[model samples]
Target: MAALAATDSADLEKLLLEVCSSPSWAADVAASRPWSDRGALLAANAAAMARLTTADLADAMAGHARIGSPKAGDATSEREQAGIQGVDRALLDELHGANAAYEAKFGHVFLICATGRTAATMLAALRERFPNDPATEAEIVRGELRKINDIRLGRLLDEPS
Candidate 1:
C-alpha cells in the first residue's frame, strides 16, 4: 500500500478505489497519495469530503448505516460500542425519527461520528443540525465525515501492532 502511494496518479486512484467505498470517500482521497506530512493528508481529505455534493453525501451516508454502535462479534458494532452508549429502545426510536426527519429535510441520511457518544447525544446533534441550510449542512457533514475518518483510520493503523 505504501508503495502504491509513491506510484502515478492512476495507480493511486486504483488503490483508493480498492481501499474505500463511496461512503468513505475522504479515506479514499487520503489514501490516494503519499503525503510528506500527516497534516497535508488530513487537509486533502477534508477538502475532498467538502467537495462532495448533497447527492454524493447522501450516497455516502446510505453506505454507512451499519456503522453505528457495534454488536457483539461485529466489527462495526464493536467500533460503535466504544462511542455509543445508552442506546436503549426509546433512544433508538428517537434516533430513527431524527434520522428520518433529517433525511427528509436534506434528502440525505444524517451523518455523525457515533464513537463515544450516547444515543441521546447523537439524537441531540441530529436535531440541532436539522435546522441548517444546505450550504451550512454540507460543511457540517464534512466535519462529521472527517471525525469518522479519523476514528476509522486510527483503528486501521492500530491493528495487531
Candidate 2:
C-alpha cells in the first residue's frame, strides 16, 4: 500500500490499469491514492467502479479475454482461467460456443472472476446469466469486474516494492 501510494502518478495509473482496463477507473484510483491499507484501496476500487459509465465498463471488459480462451501471453488470464486448461475438448468446444452466444446477447465479453472457479462453474454462470436483461447483466458485470480487480490488486500489492 505504501509503495503504491508513493508511486508517481503516471506509473501508478499504469499499474491500476492492469487491475482494471478502464482509463477512468485507473485515473480515479490513482487520484484517490495514499491509501492507508489494503481495505482502503479496495474501497476506492469499489467507489471507482460505481462511478464508471456504461461505455467505461465496456472498455474495462474489453481488456479481459473470453472465458475458455485465455490470451497466449496474458499470465493473469492464464492463471485465472487455469481450470479451462487441459479440459475435455468437447467441453471446451461447448464453452466456446457459449461464449459466442453470450457475446452476441450482451454485445460484450462475458466477465467473471475465474480465479478459484472451474470451467464448468463458469459455464453454468454464463448460461444462467444468458437470460438477463441488459441492465441486470451490466450490474452483474460491474460486480464481477470488482471481484477481478480486487484479486488483481491483491496480487499487485504482493509484488516487491
Query: What's the TM-score of every candidate structure?
Result: 0.71, 0.98
Give the number of the best model, judged by lDDT: 2
**Residues 23-78, candidate 1, lDDT per residue (tens digit)?**
44744574546665555556656676767766667655654553233446656646
Please give, for residues 48-120, the per-residue lDDT of candidate 2 as tens digits. 9999999899889989999999999989989999999878998899899999999998899999999998889
Clash count, predicted structure 1: 6
RMSD (Cα, Å) of model 1: 4.0
Predictions: Cα RMSD each: 4.0, 0.7
lDDT of 2 at 30: 89
Number of backbone-clashing residue pairs for each candidate, in the order shown? 6, 0
RMSD of 2: 0.7
